[model samples]
Every structure is written in structure tokens, then in C-alpha cells.
Target: MMGEAARERRQFWWFMLFALLVIGAGIGLRAPWPADEPRFVLVARQMWESGQWLFPHRGSELYSDKPPLYFWLLGASYALVRQWNIAFLLPSLLAALGTLTLTYDFARRSWNHRVGLWAAAAVLFSFQFVYQAKRAQIDPTVVFFITVGVYGIGRHVLLGPNWRWYWLGCFAAGLGVISKGVGFIALLALLPYALMRWRGWNGLSEPAPRGAGKWWLGGASFLLAIALWFVPMLVTALVSGDPEHRAYLNDLLYRQTATRYVSAWHHHAPWWYFIKVILTQWLPFVVFLPWLLGPWRQAWRQRDARVWWPLAWLLLVLLFFSASPGKRDMYILPALPALAWAAASFMPALVQRRGLRWALWVFSMLLGVGLLAVGLAALFGNPGYEARLVAERGLEVGSGALWLWRVLALMGALIVIAGIVCRLRHVLLFTALGVAVTWLGYGFGIAPLLDGESSSRDLMHEAREQAGADTVIGLVNWREQQLLQAVGPVTEFGFKQPEDEQWRRGIAWLQAEPTQRVLLSQDVAMPDCVDRGQIHPLGAANRRSWLLVDAQAVAGCR
Candidate 1:
């Protein structure tokens, strides 16, 4: 008994060490928030500065695609950092931490401490979770709420009926609705639990306790919480006189959802798209899924209500997202915690099997090593030839840091070795494997990708430097507009104008101020100048490249 307790204590700390390592690895490989993250952050910042909570703005335009809850949270975070680049990522970081905590709690209660630790480590290290959590997007936030709702429901239904737990579940669902439109998915995820409970009640010879009233109260509270956000938005839409506000309502409520469900917007991949992503995204754990099915069956046959709830949640979320018209890699995040729980339940059995454990460890280690090798090559490998090509062609190399390759290589090798050692010892090898894979993939592999895409930042800085403080910057194309907007203010010249007039005006402007440095996409031809100078290519600190033209060269050309 004493030895077992000592082992448990050591295992507990090991899990903590793995979780912290995953978090630290992510922090080490940092980048500015990508498209949705930065866009949402900007809206949140605008709301905070403008003192308008209901209406979010991006510069002068009203941005209303998403609810204000995430922005509100991010805005509060921004208040502390005062730097948009780093501040916007706070919500994601918090959500990631919350996910880790909830995963740990669910796994610990369902299985043993070791399984809980593995589940937490799996979530922290999962490539999809790591990549999404580092950004300023709402996926992680939605996943957090979903996890909370699942945990609450599991406790309420599995551990006997507790009104407080049910109420907490409702609260989580409400917050989920505010975070994203997918809050109802949580309820769907619980259907398996409801079914199991009903079956258990049927088998009993004695009359079951009547608790419909409790369920009603919980459901009502959830609906009321959701109404707090939705009702106001609906009323504002009905009363607002501005066409733009009405347009926002139409687009956000009807168009976006309807289009997403009925007509594909962006990602129109085949139905099997999610299947591939799930298989690869979960990686080593996906291998253990076969082991879960047997236990899942046993739990269902025994009417083990505790186990079925998480299984139901996982299936329901997967089915719901799979059916949606709009899908992305990140859409599957909400399902991961439940999957982790299910996977963790089988961990002890898996650990006991020497052959199976050895195979898993070897495979995971090799995969980690491969990923690490790629990261290291990207980080340290000289793209000198690529850089020269970009410079010669007057194009920015969009790919980022050479050192990222090295980081990936080193991390991958370490993980592979750890997985093998853990398997050989028949110890808590899964936890070690999970830690190594997550730290390297997230810290070294994905972080470098973010850093490599630094062309936009560099371009913005160069434009600001050359254009002068008072220069009126204008973009020739939408792509240029996106790149320019990311860095500094540059008016979009061609969005509203007729093609002929827009092109003519753009050319004329370039001709009129050849001495004023202007940024143009590589596709655009340089104006005729008497003494044309070379175009200067801007290198991104980490990822992509861009080109900057001298104002004097353009002036001299004509």
C-alpha cells in the first residue's frame, strides 16, 4: 500500500510536469495572431476604446459576424497588455489552460490519476489543439465551454442527480451559446447519457424518483442565460434605423448560418475531410480508439451511466460537426476532451499489455522525431537561395524562420527516444510520449510556421518608414489591402471603383508622385521612369516575404 501510494504521488507530479512542459513549449514558439484572431482582437479593442459593448468595429466599419462575449473577454485582456499583438492571445491561452484543467478533472474521476494525467497531456499536446489555442480565435473558447458543459453533465447524471451540478451545466451551455453558435451541440453530446439513464430506470423493479421538475428548472435557467445575449441583439436589429446595422443582422443571423448549412462558403472538402483530419490530428491516441470500443460496449451493457455520458458527448459532437456545411480543422476541437476521457479509460489496460504498449511508444516516438526534424530544418536551414530569388524577382519570401526546422528536429528526436524508453520500462510511458510529442510539435514545429509568416509585419514597417508620416497610402489590390492593413493604414483604392477608372487612377497616382515610395504587389508592373531603380525585397522575420519599391525610382522612370 505504501509503495502504491508513493507511485501514485510520483505519477501525479509527472503528469503536472508534462502539462507544464506542453504549455511552456507552446509559449516558446510564439507568433502574432493570424487572420481571425487579429481581426477579432481589433474589433474587441475598438469596442473597449470606443465604449460600445454591443456594436463591434474594425477601424470605421461595423464588425458583427460573431457575438461580443469573446471580444469582451479579449478586450479586458487587452486592457492589461496594451499591445494588440500579445494581448489578443490571452483568451486563447486561458481557454487552453481551462481545457487542461477540465480534461484532468474528467479523466481523474472516470479512471485513475495516471489516466487523468495522460488525458490532460494528450489535449495539451494534440497538434490541432496546440495550433488553435495559440491563436486569438474563438474555437478554444467554444471548446472550453463545451468541456465545462460536458463535465457538469457528467457529474450531474453520473454521480447521482445534483441540482447544483445541473445548474452549472446550464450555465456552461449558456456561455457556450454566447461564445459561438454551437452551444446546443453540448446537449446533443449528452443524449447518450439520457438514454442510458432512461434504460437504468426501466430495469429497476421500484419506481424511479420523479425529477422532471429539476430538469425543467435547469433547462429554463439555461434558456434564460442564453436569452440575455440573443434577445438584446434581436431587439437592436429590429429597432436600429441604419441600413448597415440591419445588414449586419441579416448577414450574421440568417445569411452566415443559412449559407453555411445550405451552401458551402469556403471549405467544401469531401465528406471524408474531417475523417482524415481526426485521424491525423489525434495521432497516437487515434490508435487507442479500438481499445475504447470494447469498454464502451461493456459500459453500455452494464448500463454504466458514468462512462456512457462522455462517449455520447464525443459521438454527438463528431456527428454534429460532420453534418455542418461550414467546417474547418478547428471545428472538431470540442469533441477532443470527451475522446480523451474515453481514451484514458483504457490507458491502464493498454499499459498492462507489453507488446501493445511497445508498439504505440515506438510509433509515437518516430512520428515525433520526424516532426522535430522538419522544424529544425526550417529553423536553421539557410533559405539563402530562396531569399536571393525573392530579392532578384522583387518578391517577398513569405516563408519564415530557418531555425524552426532545427527546433522541430531536436524535439522530434527527443520524443521518439522518450517513447521507446517509457515503453521498455512499462512505466507511465504514454504520459512521457504525450509530453514529448506535444512540446516539440507545438513549440518547435507550429511556432516556427507562425514566425515565418512575418512578411506582413515587415512590409507594414517599411511602408510606414518610406511613405512618411503624412503620406496617403493606397493599395492596388485586395491582397495588398490585407497585407497593408495588417501593418498600418493604407487606403484600399480599387474596392469600390470601376475597373477602368480604378486602374487609370492608380497609374496616374503612381506617375504623379514617382518620388513618393508606394507599395505594390509583384503582379503590378512598375510605371515608366527615366531612371528606374531596383525594387527592395522585404524579408519576414519568420515565414513569408514582400517587396518594397523606391519612390525615387518610380519618379525617375516617368
Candidate 2:
């Protein structure tokens, strides 16, 4: 008979392997795509090149939108690997893996290895978690830090008066704050601990008077982590006497953190928006929700601190994001680990229930059939929607569109067959298999097919070819992708500059050496002063039309 330790070691490695396959499959297969990836990668690239670790820049402007910790990680990754594509996404990948490891261990220590594996699996296969893990974003790293905080505090509260773990958790939360500004959300776990203690909860550390100094130590550890980045950056910004540096300091400290949270400028939605996100974005795991409610209520009635701590933390996080006027789907991602932990505590028996199994099977069928329908429509028929997508995405109808839809169709067919074969007896297995296929399909197959146009690689390639090797190109209202993918000499007027100012600067740059220089501008940013007849369209990228123009296109107006 194998020992429990050996079994746990084997299971842990297997779960990690599965996570790596799901999240790390397409690391180098595609360049960063937009909405956030390109901007973050561009900032990191500039940081690496300029050796300016304190102040991040987007184009020629100071980037005060996010704290510098994430950018620092990206720069460090680049230094180690020296490849932009892989280096750009390395931190998120490692952070995700770290998160999974911490989740697995925390659950294992809290309940048993079986619960740990289930908890880790629940997080691994979730749509939102996998989606964010694969992308080069700050959220995954933030999620990891927050999860670490939860694990540390939960361990100390449930397992021991182990002040060391408590302090470590506090330190991780501090790191989380530097990583995203919401790291302190990790400390919210303590709120439930306090309540549980007051309520005379079972399964808590033997009541021991932890001195106030110990509590202060945790806060100091958190501050120390923040001070690692904040102090040096703040001191430099204050003493530098540079206006841009001061502006960066003010914006990052004030506008981006507190002000943005209180009054979001964009992506606004109703209060119930996160509830909708939880229902949809957190799928497969939520498929067990119906079966979970009774067990959760029972756990609460029994006063289980292990269950209450994470569940309460999850609720607090949900309320935190939901109360904000501005919301995005990924905002609730950090709460997922807690959800997985609470759910996995009951998942062992819940999986055996016939109703939950049927629900999983039904969900699998719907997902598979949905994918099949969309793939079939794109493949066999020239539907108006398909045509519009191809045009908007600038995909080659002959190759790009064909390959993408075929991969989707193939994946859907496999999932449908898996669901049918697995049936009720193995329906739980079917859900895991189906999610694995979907992510692997997306990472290895679909992402590469769309990489060229989606990353603006092809558009920049065309621009480079048309302008010749010696030509200098100036960008007007250009995206980060265009600047990142440029082959030869390139200059951006400004990323955050107004349209008129960018156009004015671009035109002047073009006129400096008209024969040797060209300007690339979005169609919407094209100035009336430019001669439309002399402008050449460079095709569509990221659903925007771009035009290449020469000084001759500058007609008359200043």
C-alpha cells in the first residue's frame, strides 16, 4: 500500500502538469494582443530599454495608470530570457502556477489531499481563470499575491497561532497592493476570523492571546513589501524636480488608485453586473452551485472556520467590486480561489450526486453544440456575420478564416463526443476533459491563426515594406501593437496626446524629409490638411483602418 505522502506528491505534480498544459501551452505562439496586453508589454519593453525602473512610459508620455511592480516583473523576465514574446508573458504564467500551487497546498492542509486536488482543479478549469492566466495581464499576478495572502492568513487562523505564516500572508498582500492597488483585499480574511472567534467557532486555533505586537508585525511586513517599491520611487520622484515625474507620482498615487475606484471613467455597468459575471464567466465550477447551497448552509450553521473564512472573503471581494460604479469581468478573478476552496470542501460528495453529474453533462453538451454551430456557420456558409468578422479582423478568407473555424469545429466535435461517451457515470471527468480541450484548442490552435492580424503584425509588416528599409515612419493615433511590431525606424508623436496635436506633429515629421519619411494614421485621425488622393490605405487591423501618407498628401492648411 502506498503511503499518503507519496500519493499526495504524485497528485500534486499531476495537477501542476495539467495546469501548465492549460495555461502555458501557447506562451511563444503569439505576440501580445490589444485591449491591455500591448500597452503593458510596450511599457515593459521601454523600461527594459531605457533603464528607467521608477517611471514607466507609453510612447513619449508618462504611464501612471498602474503601479510599477508588474512592469518590473516584465522587465526582469526580459532580462532573464531576452525574448520579448516569451518574456512579456512569463510573470503572469509563473504567477498563475504559483497560485495553483498555493491553492492546492492550502486545501490539502486544510482538509485533505482529495479536497486540495479538487479545489485546484476547480480553479484551473474555470473559464475566467484560464482566460486571464493565458494572457499577459496584471490580474493574474495580483490574483496570485492575493491568494498567497489568503493561504497564509487562513493557515494561521485555522491551523495554528503560527505568526510566521500570518506575517507572510500580510507581506504577500502588501506585494499585491504594489502589483495592483487592491492587494489589501487579502487582509479581509481576518474580518471573518474575528467574527468566527466571537461566535465561538469550532476548528480554530486554540484560543491564545496573540500580543498586539504580533498583529503590528503583520502590518509592518505588508508595509515593508510596499516600501520596497514605494519608498525609492517616491523619494526619486519628489527630489527629481521633473514635472513629468511629479505628475506620474500624483496620478499613480491619487487618480489611478483611489479616485479611479471611486469614480470610474469607463466600462461602467449596473451593480448587478458582477453577479452576471459570476454566473457566466465562472462556469463549470458554478455548474455545481445548485448542489453546493445546502452543504454551504450546513457548514455555516456548524460554524466551520475553514469554510467561513474563504467564503466570507469571497463575499467581501464581490461586494467590493460590485459597489464600484465601474466594473470589468476580470475584476472578480481574485475571489475565484476562495470560491474554489469553499466549493471543493463539498465537491467530493457533490460529484457523486446524480443531479450534479447530469447538470455537468448538460452544460458540456450546450457548450459543445454552441461551438459547433458557430464553427459550422463560419466554415460552410458565407453568412453576413462571418463576412463582417473576416473584414473587421482583416483575416485572409482563403486561409486564416478557414483554419480558425476548422479548429473550432474540431474542438467542438471532440467535446460533444466526450460528453456522450462519458455519460452520467463519468460526467465529472467529461467536464474536466472538455475544459482542457477548449483552452488547449484556444492556446495552440485558434490564437496563432488570429495572431497576425490581431497583433497588428501584418499591418506593420506592410507599412514597413511600403516605406522601404531607409524610410522613417511617424505614427499618429497608433496603437501599441504597431509601435511594438515596427521593423525599421519608427517614431510616435505621443500615445496620450490629443488627435490634433498628434496629427500636427506627424505632419511636421513627415515634411522634415518627405522623400525619406512617411506617416501612418488611423482613418479617424486623418487631418483635413492631408490630400486624400495621395494617401494610401494600409488595410485594417484591430478593427481600425490605417492610412500611410507622404508630405505630398499635405495639401495647404497648417
Candidate 3:
């Protein structure tokens, strides 16, 4: 009894530590959520301010790419922060924590506490998971629901056939669908559960009575949950005769789903793409994946109920992402908990294997050397050369690569040294510690630098100040439209627009403007009035050349 209690206590602490590490690392690796996060926050803030729940606003224009759940969450967060900045990322942080909890729960129920701990650790430290958690994007929400669905299914399957758990699974699936459209429901989570149950007779072997009534109840609950959102959306679309509603429906249902299956926008990769992403993103944990596969095959061969279920879950997820035409690096976040489970389940066996310690030590050493070399190079390297290289090659290096390099190098060195110590003592605890430290350093130290550079808050503030409150803002070209929209509403005039024709009429219209301030791109061909000393360059934002035109003097050009 004492031994069992001790084991339970140890597992509890380990799980807690795992949760803390994941959350802490995520918090530390703070990058301003890129691309989607800023837009999501802006729209949500607008929603809060305008009280427009149906139409997502980007400045004065309607922006419709996603559903309302993420925006609603961000809007609430924005109120708390008293600003629509990084605070919007709170949802992602919460989702990440939820993912950790779900992962632990699922692993513990299916396998053992050790596997649970490892799975939790993997979810926390995996590169993509950590990255997504820190960003204010929809992916973390998707991950959260997917995690919940997986855990719910795992519980239902492991604890005999329970309609209650299946209902919970349906609810989770509904949340997942609302979070990121139908893909989470149709592709990632539900299909896996169905395949696992169909192939593995583990569900039938359960001690609980399995009847047709239970299945019908479970199915009805799932359908009802899904209808709650989509049915409302459909009804709303029908009531509103707005052309924009039709556009949104087509974009979400057709373009995003049907087009994604056949065409690639931002996430087009070859079939082997997921393989590389998994290896790199999951890192050292991926090394133990082969052990899981061997056991997986053996379990299926022997028709073992315990092993086939989880293995089936893992395979379904892997196959779904692999077969999908639209693929991104972070698409593997849903599969991570399972991989972690597989890796952790075999960790003890792997630790006992001969030469495993040497291999770990060598891997740690290599990582250390690589990080050190990169850090030194970045620290001493010329900024001009770096910029030139980026410009020439269009390479995407992390903005804070130099800082990240130094931190990663130090962490890697510590891991190598720790691994060497563990090698002599043959302690798996040391190996775990080393990896944890390294992951912590990578997330916390490296993430901030990257985020600082990416954040547009400061830039927006400067632009607003330079342009002044009363300035009638206009884009120099179409390319600047998105950037200007992010800052605030601006009068956009294309080269062929009637507004451009009026502006081309000369200085009289410019001088009659309220603020007499015109923002023009350096790349655009300036009007004759600009060269005639009618415009003065106030200041630059984003290092892009922008000229402030004086409306008073432009009147003489007419």
C-alpha cells in the first residue's frame, strides 16, 4: 500500500511538473502571433467596440475568413488587457494548458502514469505545440478540442462502452468543428475514433453492455451538438440577404474546404513533408517512435486489445494528415499526444537497452555544438550581411536568431554535460532533466526575440502619430492596403479608382483636405506636386519610404 501510494504521489508531481513546464515554456517563447493573430485581435476588438457579432471588421471593411468563437474569446481578452495587443493570446495559452491536461488524462487511462508523464512532456515541449500556444491563432483552439475528443474517446473505449463519455466526445467534436471548421470533425478526430473501433474489437471486449441503443444515443448527441452552430449559421444566412453572407459561405465551405483538398495556398507540401515536420518538431522524443511501432505491429498481430486501440488512434491521425492536400508544419499538433504516449510507454525499455545512453550523449553533444556554432556566428556576424542574405535568398531566419543561438547553445551544452553524468550513473531522470532544460531555454529565451521583431504595435502607434489624428490617410498602392488596414481605417484609392483621378486633378483638392497630410509609398510614382516641394517627409515607419504631402502648397499646382 505504501509503495502504491508513493508511486501515485510521484506520478501526481510529475504530471504537475509537466503542465508547469509546458505553460512556462510557452509563456517564455513569446512571439507576437504572426499573420493570423494580429488580424484576429483587430477584428475581435472591432467586434467589441461596434457590437457587431456577425460581421468581422478589419477597420471599416468586412473581414470574413473564420468563425466567431476565436474572435469572441479575443474580444473578451482585449477588454481585460484594456488594449487589443498581446493579451489576445490568452485563449491560446489556456488552450495549451487544456491540451496538457487532456494528454495526461488520456495517456494515464490507456497505458500507465509514466506514459502519461512523457505524453504531457511531449505536448508541452514539441516545437509546434509550444509555438502555437504562444500565438493568438485558431490552431491552439483546434488542438484543444482535438485533445478533448481524443481523451473522451480514450475514456469511452478503455472504461467499457459508456454513452456518457461518447456524448462528451460529441461535445468536444462540436467545439473542434466550431473552432476550425469541419476538418477537425471529419478528418482529424472522429475518423480516427471510427477506424480504431472498426479495426480493433477492443470496444466489444469491454465488460459493459454494448447495445444498438447506446450507439444511437451517442450518434444523436453528436449530430445535435454539431447542428447547434451550423444550423444557426444557415438560418442567419437565409434571413440576411447580404451578398457578403453568400461570399462568406462560399469561402468557408467551398474555398477553405473543397479548394484546400485540391489546391494549395500557403501550406502545400509533398507527401513526405509531414515526416520531416514530425522529426524536427518532436525532436528527441521522435527517436523512440520505432519502439512504439514494433509493439504496435506485435499488438495487432496478437490481437491485443490494450495496444491495438491506441495504435489505431495514432495510425488514423498520421494517415489523415499525410493524405490531406493542405498541409502545414503545425498540422501534426493533433498527432503529438499519441506519439508522446507511444514514446513514453517504451521509455523504460529504451533506457534499459544497451548503448542507448551513448546515443543520447552523442545526440546532446551534437546539438550543443550546432547551437554554439550558430550563436557565435550570429553574435559576430554583420547585420548588413544578414539583411543582404535574406534579401538575396528570401530566407526566413528567426528575427532573434542570435539571442536564440546563445541560449540554445548554453542549454545544449548543459544537456550534453548532464547526459554524460547520467551515462555514468545510468539514470533516466538525468536524461529527462537535460531535455527539459534545453526545451525551456529554447522556448523562453529564443521566442521573445522573434516576437519583439514581429510585433506591429509600436509601428502602428508611430504611424498614427506621424500621420496625426485628422489626416485623411490614403494608400500609395494596393500593396500597402493590408498594412494600412491593420493600423486603422484609411481611404484606399487604387491607381484606376475615381478617387485617384480626383487626386490626379492636382493641389486644389489636396489643399482643401482637412489635415492636408497624404501618405504615399516611396515606390509609387509621385505627382508633379510632390517634387515641386509641396510634400515634406515627416518620418518613416517599417523603414519603407513614406512622404507627407502638404495640401496647402499643392493647391498652386492646379
Candidate 4:
């Protein structure tokens, strides 16, 4: 018979394999879609092409919404792979794997190998976790850095007075802050550690030397990581003496960070918004909360420092984000590792309960049934909403739309079968299997089907073709995807410039030569001076209709 150690080693590798397949699927199958992906990838591509790494740009506008760390990773990955399609998504995929590995190792050391495997699996299957991991978003990278910082601090406080680990953790957190301005969320772990030490909690390391020097060392490490980016950025911006560079620097440091947090300008939500996010987005894991609460209370009664430390930090993170009026669903993502660690010990037992198993089976069935119903409707019933969706997606009713329905139906059928086959015998595995199928189907099957129009590749291609090979195409009210996917000679009036101004410039450019230059613009941005009858339809993309206008479309107005 195999020993326990050997069995755990086998399980760890299997879990990793599963994670790799789920997160890394469909990487090169699609172009960057809008809302954020195209913007980041464009900035990275410009950095690689223009040799400008200090400041990121989006079609002539200085991109100041985020720091350069994530873009650097994207550019670095592109340098290695030499494929923008793969490079843009590679960082998130690697970061997600790094996060899962960290979660598994930390759980194994703190509790047992079994708990470690379950914790990693739980995180892997979480809807929000895997969804973001598959995208080119900055959150996955930030989450990885924050997890490292937490792991380091937890090693020092709960496992030992290891100063080096604490410093390492702080430094990782600093990297996280530069990634998204939330890296210091890792150091919040120390607050709960101090309280636990005061109460003489069990399972804590022996107290370290009573000197301020040790504490200052960790601070220095954090600052050093921040300085790697900040000092260079500040020095370059000051030395350049460019007004745009100075504005970018000031906006990032002041408005984007502290001012944005204190008075969030967008995505405003109530205090209870994150509560809703936790219950829904953290699914399968959140499903076990009722069972976990009792075990957590018992652990607290026993003064288990391991359990208390993570839970306390989780609470602090929730409060910290909830206190900010401008709340986004992903803002609370950094705390997920702490929550997974606290819940890992109990997952092994919670999976055995009949109530939890039944709940999971029902959840799986509902999800599967919903997808199946929608697929059937799209396939046969000709639902109004479905037709409208097809129109908006710029897909014909035949091949493009049919493939999407087929993939959904296939995923739904697979999920239903996986749930039934696993049932009460292995409900958690059912969850994992169901999630895996969903991601694989979406990645390999659905993403490609929608890529042409969703990523604006089709729209840009049509614009280029209609304008002829040698003609210069001008863009108005443009998105990054349009700018990135555009072919041949293309000119953008401005991305961040006013809609009226962009239309004015685009019309002027097109009017300069009636048949030689064409302008592509969002329907909403086309001016009254342009005759709608003369404009050729370029179909819809990114949920907006676009039209190609030439000099003939202009109604004798500048």
C-alpha cells in the first residue's frame, strides 16, 4: 500500500494539472475584447514597438489609470513569445497558477496536505477567481503578489518570528501596491497577529526581539519595492519637463490613488455591495459557509491562532474596501486567499455532509438547466432577445450563431452528466468537474465564435476593405480594439478627445478627398452634417453600431 506522503504527492500533481487545464485554455483563440483588455494590450504593444516603458499610451493619450508594472509583464511576455495573442493573456495565466501553488503550500504547512489540496481546488473553482484568471486583467497579478505577502507574514507571525519572511512578505505587498495600489493589504495581517499575541493565542511563534529595528526592516523592504517603480517614474517625469508627463505623474499619485479611493468617481455602490459579491461570486466556497461557521467558532474557542489570524485579516480587508464608497466587485479579491486559508481546514469534513452535497447538486443542476434552456431557445424557438443578441454580435443566423448555441448545449449536457455521475459519492468533485467543463467549453468553443465581432476585428477589417488598401481611414469615438485591429494606413482623431471634436476632425479628413479617404465612427458620434443615407453600414461591434462615411456623406458642412 502506498504511504500517506506518496498519496498526497500524487494528489498535489493531479490538482495542479486540473488547474493548468482550466486556467490556460483558449489563450490564443481570441483577440483582446473591450472594457479593459484591448487597452492594456495596446499600451504594452506600444511600449514594445516605441521603446517607451516609463509611461503607457493609448492612441496618443497618456494612459494614467494604472501603474506600469502590469504592462511591463505583458511587454516582457510578448518579447518572449513574439505573439500578441498569447503574450497578452500569459501573465494572468501564470499569476493564477502561482496563486494556486502558494495557496496549496501554505495550507499544507499550516494544516495538512489534504486541506491544502482542497483549499487550492476551492479557489480554482471559484467563479470570479477563474473568470478573472482567464482574462488579461491586472487583478490576477495583484492577487498573486498579495498572496505571497500574506504567506510570508503568516510564516513569520503564526509559524515563527522569522524576520526575513516578514520582510519578504512586505516587499511582495509593495509590488502588489504598484500593480494596483492595494499591495499593502497584505501587511494588514500583522494587526491580527498583534492582537493574537496579546491574548496569548495558541500555535503562535515565540516572541521575537523587542526592538523597533526589526519592524523598521520590513517597512524598508516595502518602500524598496515601491521605489523600484516610483523613484524612476518620478525622476523621469521631472527631468523630461513635458506637461503631459507631469500630468500623468500627478494624476497617478494623487487622483488615481488617494483621491479615487476617498471619493470614488465611478462604480458607486452601497456598503452591502461586497456582501452580495461574497455570497454570489465566491460560490461553491460560499456554499459551505454555514458549515464553516460552527467549526470556525470552535477553533476560536480553542484559541487557534492559525484560524483567528486569517479570519481577522479577512474582516479587516472587507471593512477597508467597504468603507470606500466606490466599490468594484474585484476590489475584494485580494482577501480571497485569507478566506481560503481559514476555510481549508474545515473543507475536508464539510464535503461529507448530506445537506451540503444536496445543495451543490441542486446548484449544478440549476446552472446546467439554465444554459441548456437558453441554448435550446436559440437553436429552435427564435427568441426575440436571442435574435437581437445575434444582430448586436454581428453574427449571421446560420454558422456563427449556431456554433455558440451548440457549445452552450454541449457544456450544459456535460455539466449535467458530471453532476449525476458524481452525485453524493463525490459532490465536491462534481463541482470541480462541472466548472472545468464550463471553462473549457467557453475557452475552446465560445470565445472563438464571438471573437470576430466582440473583439472588433471584423469591424476594423470591414472598414479597411471598404476604404481600399491605399486609402487612409480615420476613426471617431474609437475604442482601443478598433485602433489595435485596424489595418494599413489608419488615423485616429483622438481616443480621449471630446466626441464632437473627434467627429469634426474625422469629417474634415474624409472631406479633404471624396473617394480617397473614409471615416469609420460610432453611430452616436456621427454629426448632423453627415448624410445618413450616403454612409455605408459597417455592422455592430462592442454593442455599438458603426458607419463608414466618405466625402459624399458630408452635407456641405465642415
Q: Pick the candidate with the highest TM-score.
A: 2
Kindly list the per-residue Cα lDDT of model 2 for residues 304-415, writing each as its tens digit.
Answer: 8788788898999999999889899998999998988888889989888888888889998888988888899888887788888889899888888898889889889999
Off by over 4 Å in 2: none
lDDT of 1 at 4: 92
The sequence of per-residue lDDT tens digits that candidate 1 reaches over residues 311-430 is 667767777677766678888788888878766766667656766566566666667766766555445565465355334433334443344344556667777667656656643455
Q: How well is each residue in 217-278 modelled by candidate 3, as lDDT tens digits?
A: 65666566667666777777778997767777677777766677677576767888888988
TM-score for each predicted model, relative to the true structure: 0.80, 0.98, 0.80, 0.97
> Which residue runs of candidate 3 sit more than 4 Å off their true CA positions?
1-10, 25-31, 79-86, 182-205, 380-444, 450-452, 469-472, 475-515, 520-558
RMSD of each candidate relative to the true structure: 5.2, 1.2, 5.2, 1.5
Weakest lDDT window of 10 consecutive positions for candidate 1: 201-210
**Model 2, residue pairs in steric clash:** none
RMSD of 4: 1.5
Once fitted onto the true fold, the runs of candidate 4 whose alpha carbons sit more than 4 angstroms away are 1-4, 513-515
Q: After superposition, how far is residue 447 of candidate 4 from its true place, in Å?
A: 0.6
**Of the pair 1 and 3, which is ahead by lDDT?**
1
Error of 1 at 503 (Å): 6.5
Cα error of candidate 3 at position 81, Å: 5.0
User: Can you tell me which runs of candidate 1 are displaced by over 4 Å?
Assistant: 1-17, 24-31, 111-115, 201-211, 372-402, 416-423, 426-434, 437-452, 476-489, 492-558
lDDT of each: 0.64, 0.89, 0.61, 0.89
